[model samples]
Target: MSAQFELPRDGVTRIMAAPPRLNLRRAASYQNDKGPLSSTSSRFNFNHLVFSPPPSPGLPPPLVTRPRKLSNAPRPSRVFRFVFWVASLVAFLYVASLFARRFVGHVPSVMSWAIESQDEYEMVGQDELPDFPTPIAVTDVHGRSKWTVSIPPTHTFPLSVQEYADMCAQCHEVAVHVRELHGESTSKQQARASYYYRDPYFVDVGEAESHGLLPGFSKTSKATGRSLAKPLIGESWDYMVEKPACKTSLTFVLESADGGLGTTLMLLWMAYGLAQKEGRAFFIDDTRWAYGRYTEMFQPPPPADCVPPPRHEMLPCPHGARHLVVSAGTARDTFGPAFTAQFEDVRQDSIERERPLFNLARVGYEALFRINKDDRPYVMERIEELKLKTTHGTNGDAANSTIIGVHVRHGDVHPVEYQYNGAYIPLTIYKERIQQAAVAQHNRAMPESVEPAPAPLVVLASDDPRVFESEEFSGVIRAQERIKLAGKVPVVQPVLDKSVMHPFKEEAVGWEGGFFRVMFWNLGRPSIASKQTQISLAPEATKLRAFIGRAYVMDLAVLGATSDVMVCTISAMGCRLLAVMMGWEKAMVKEQWVNIDGDYSWVAL
Candidate 1:
């Protein structure tokens, strides 16, 4: 059976999901699962101290020749001096309390992202650094938003099956089987005419619906649709999907080039949260997305039946816009700098400071993200296999081991995705934290018992394939053979184009599907990883990117749903989602979240 994590609507939700509830005592929810009972939590997040001063001594009367000359200026008396000293101490303590978490409070061991020193220097203009992306683009009040258009959630006019079929007659998929592209040999004919990656938006609504002539789809035959893909949750939605009267809708246009699946998901969640709070509609536009159809991987945004106002009626800025269209490019301008600073003045304690953002993030999780239809079964299979592989008891009969979810990201991220540095957390640091967690768990467990400590199983995910191959994680790493995902991360394979990567190409020797092989057609390709969307619309690259996207979602879902604890670098968007998925109680309160890069904080607009 597939892992069932359906969040209960109407004042209900399950664990590992929106019930991302507020607290927990143990790491894993399962009782039979045993490896650790307690983890290192901020049990004492901040100190609460009370101070008292000793009684002031009475001024000696006449013993001193104190009144010889009364100065016009008031002399410092014992009471005044004592009050001044007390005031200074209070001010000092106030400042100390602000940074107590980073200093006085117990902090999990932190590791650097192995960032290069040059990255620390502030960002230069786009023209100044032509080869790299700007670290973070500050929005301009007068500038036009990149997402100037908005496409309705429901097709503005339902695209009929016959019309779509007739329209897409030319340049249709020849069906040589895209999975064959992963094969070692590509025949000459296959190269000339075969399916590798379909053109963007090739799989239209009509092609995917495959059904009856009603308002909603009804399947009469066992025929599969044009696209083989499906979201982990809902495969199809109904006509007039949302309330007709809805006038305000938040459309998240994909800035497909900016970041990978993780970033897109995070931003979408943020949009969802904002829409809910503002009572606005929300939708996603993947027309220009490098990965092709949004529905190919996940469910469309919840119903907003009304079609969006014309592009002219839409506004880039959020303040006065009737219909809002935002992309990564327009986020800062839309939200403005004030939104980012909201949590800045909040408590520095990890949980409290993060509460405001976490609330919104959790709402996003509960409102939208769900286990898609395709990956549902695999989520459980992966978890069961991982637990079996890392059974913690000495007899090897223990139901499950305390687990740590680790996401290691080192794919070429410098100026674009991550601003802090072009650094990556080392596996050594991850290993140390896992060991530290296990030790802390033991201390919280029955310490008098002579049982040897059990090592927690590690469910690892990383962009670099080399990380999966590391012998350093052999003892803890358990899950085997995942979707090979990589792109510009200290790769060893000597390939032609260094910009984009295909893992299957490296694994399959003598394959000519290298990047530059399509050089003439790859014209105007951006050298930086972030801006490659210009030429990445190609079938091969997009398909590979989709597969890479699958790899990421799988890792995130499995680990988020099942892991006892998450030890990942919070710098990555997926890491934040993993925490959201693990439920706040377990991840935040019980201290199941162990950030290796730094303290816990979410990325803001």
Candidate 2:
């Protein structure tokens, strides 16, 4: 622990600068000069004395020695020649320096001296000026002075968008920051600013004269057919920055003493409104803020003392010009026991039976709805007038009665399927109603001598089975006659063809359903309610529609399933009825039919 350590040796040595040596002065003789007089000596004299006396201070210095002229060696004296050469070189250097001072005056030393001694240098025009400065005279296009008022030190007159954005930040931030502060409403605010409502005429100056709406803008084109407004009126400023339209109409107006005061306030208010959300300030008079001078054009003066026409004048009625009657029955007779098998379950209570029986009634009503909504009675007056035979008839015993017609469109409208089960089915119901009405009229015309029953019903099938399926349609005809005969009547049916199809189209086009066409028709009161008219004696042809809970029930059966049970359960039915009533469909229905076993054995009314 106490051991001494030895220091290692280094080969490097420190060097020191030597002091300057002083040279000894020696005397010089002109006769015994060596090589040349020492350059330190001023001169050497050879007139007398062994060593030349130090040159007298008062005596003039020897003239720079002249070059020697010798026969053997005509050479100049080394000292004399050196002195002469030195004098010549010094004079040449002095002349060179004078030339350099004149030519290279921009050298740093000269430049610094020039700056320090500025008074010594003369300045030409503009050379001593500070910088470019604001102009003295300034005015805007309106010939209003822009320089009248001092511009505030902090306020820039025409700020760039970026600068304006920063300036706007004092009131509210721009873009995302604005969005975050204001939330969803930010976009709406931005849209308002971006779509600031300049006159639409101004936006589309080319169409201004043609529009004839703005008299002022139109006047701009009065001098020539071409509108001068197009060159002057432009698009909005907001549209210019973020998204630009074809052109910008923004203008800088010079404020006049009288006019600009109101305009200035309005502009400030507009700018303020653009920034804030909830806050409000003074009302702006936009007229004062108009950007340009405009005169009203040749506007046609309005007609004097105009009077309006009366409301609710009578419109022409198409069908017979008569008040048409449409009626539907719930049950004309419950019928005799011969038709008792047609009844639903007897064990069910009246309330339960009422539902199904009423549904059955609705099926007939549904058919009637189709005819009324779609067919025009006037167009079908001839068809309604044509009578068919009724009852088991011999030649003379035959009774003639008018044919009531019914028609339906099932998916005939193509892409907009007028389906039989939905709103579209009302057209069918109306058709059926007209058919019933015609039958009722015939029965009312029945002679009192013979017992009267409901008028006979006739349905004109528009499409030939050939139009859809020739073979199937042929079979449909055979089946349809049975339907006609079952009710104890012969149908005066039209042959299905283009002409028959025209009636269907006419009926649809002529009848427009609304409160007027579908109004309730008054029939004498039933004896059950009031004995004035016996329900029993009432025209068997009179018709009625069934409604429950204020809504028409759509088809009771689902597609491919024939029995007339509701397609949806009672609860779902309620929901669907609501949906349909809310205009999901024009109409809906609940079908009624004889459910034999599980099969729906049904006949269209």
**Model 1 spans > 4 angstroms off:** 1-243, 341-350, 387-400, 414-423, 445-450, 475-482, 486-536, 599-605
Model number with the top lDDT: 1
What's the lDDT for all of these models? Answer: 0.50, 0.25
What shift in Å separates residue 355 of candidate 1 from its native position after superposition? 1.2
RMSD of 2: 34.3
RMSD of each: 41.1, 34.3
* Candidate 2 global CA lDDT score: 0.25
RMSD of 1: 41.1
Cα lDDT tens digits, model 2, 1-605, are 87454544775554443332221233233344554455465564433243334443455668434334234753568778889999999999978865654454211110000111412322112212112111111222222221111112222223232222222222122122223433547556555432222211111212211222111222444334322222211122232345422211112122222211212322222222221221211111112111221111011111112111110000011111111101111011112221233444567643343333334333322221222221223223422223223344323334553333222222222112224323332333443444445444544565453554443333233211221232212221111221111111344666677655353331111112211111212122432454332233233222221111011111111111111111111211122222222221111222221111122222111
lDDT string, candidate 1, 1-605, tens digits: 87766756776755673232333333222222334334364332221122122222354544533223334666679679989999999999867854653344322111111113522232232311121111112111222111111122223222222222221221122112222332424464344431122222122222212211011222432123212222211122444454253377676776543545676777777777877777876766665665556655665556664544323233343233455556665555444444544434464745566566676777887766655567657767887767666564544534344777777766543213244465556568788898888666655565685775566666777656566667777644533345654334444756468677755432322212212223322333444443352333456666665665666677777778767777777666677788877777777787777777655454433
